[model samples]
Target: MEKYHIKLTEEEAGLLSKIDLRSYHQNHEEGRAAYLNNQEPILALLKSLSGRRAVPEVRLSYWNDPNYRSGRIKGSRKGLFERNGCTGSDIYTHPHFLEQLRYFLFGTELPDAVIEAFEAKVGNPEWVSSSDIVPIGKAARDLTRRYRLDIAAAPEEFFKLCLDMGLGLSAAESVMRSVKQVR
Candidate 1:
């Protein structure tokens, strides 16, 4: 796999945390156009990478999520559940937001209908039904692990990887310099 060093000032890193792509995802509920409009920054950033190499494989994990392993996905009043693959908190904030960001940036092989179902809060009575919803945990895990994710080539990708690596929003606290990818 190929990789590139990412250089970002503190300002850029903070932007990652500020980006709110998950709020409209079945949270408050917004039309597709409105949802995309609210998240223009994320879309613009992704568009900027149009000709660049696709995002490198990411090492997102589900820990030892027995539920994820057992293929038991749940949809409750709180939100969907699949072991550590996701939580109500994650869906509302942080790492899950990060994951959502990854989803938009990298795109998915999942059918457009599946993506639309996830993006919209209405329709799809299946949205509230666990049995009908595609198991996102397994799909996300499998998509993320397709390649040995050894490096990141973009600042956005790097920031996300930092959080995925458990550096959290304060990844700057530990590595104040830019990300460097090795050949």
Candidate 2:
């Protein structure tokens, strides 16, 4: 896998934590209200620093379905006790908002090295299981720990590296920001 070094300062880490706190609030009714109330100032700060929008609505209904694995939403077996009625629409219900949010938060462009690393990790059986289909989440976490200590690259660079190593984009971004302060 392609390797890049990255580091984060204390202030940057704090800012990323605040962003995560807001995101957590966005999931529930009360949290959503708090998130909405604080949206402008957070957006202003994120915009000034990264020139991108940070408040993106994310629906996690698919995550609630027990039968759902990886990105696939499988129909429950007839005899199964836990029947999941989740459909494809439930998984991809809000594509437009997701796309827009991703673009706004993380730029449209991914670095070439990052893409190469992703291709390498994703195609390997060691990284992706055939029966389960869930990519090895632990491996991705380990890679983040391995790379975050290097002082050569910026937090965003480390974030991209985490994504390339099989971490979800939002998760990787969160981790990247968590390690450093962003103001």
lDDT by residue (tens digit), candidate 2, 1-183: 213222224554454445433224335677656544444434434444443322222212112322322224354222122244434323222222233223334432345544455456556423443332223333333444554434333454445444444545555545444444422
lDDT of 1 by residue, 56-148 (tens): 333222222222111256433123434346553334343334454444343332333433432342233233344322342233223333433
Work out the TM-score per prediction: 0.23, 0.24
Task: State in Å the error of residue 106, model 2.
Answer: 7.4
Show where candidate 1 strays beyond 4 Å.
1-18, 21-36, 59-98, 102-183
Off by over 4 Å in 2: 1-9, 21-28, 37-41, 51-118, 121-183
> Clashing residue pairs in candidate 1, if any?
none
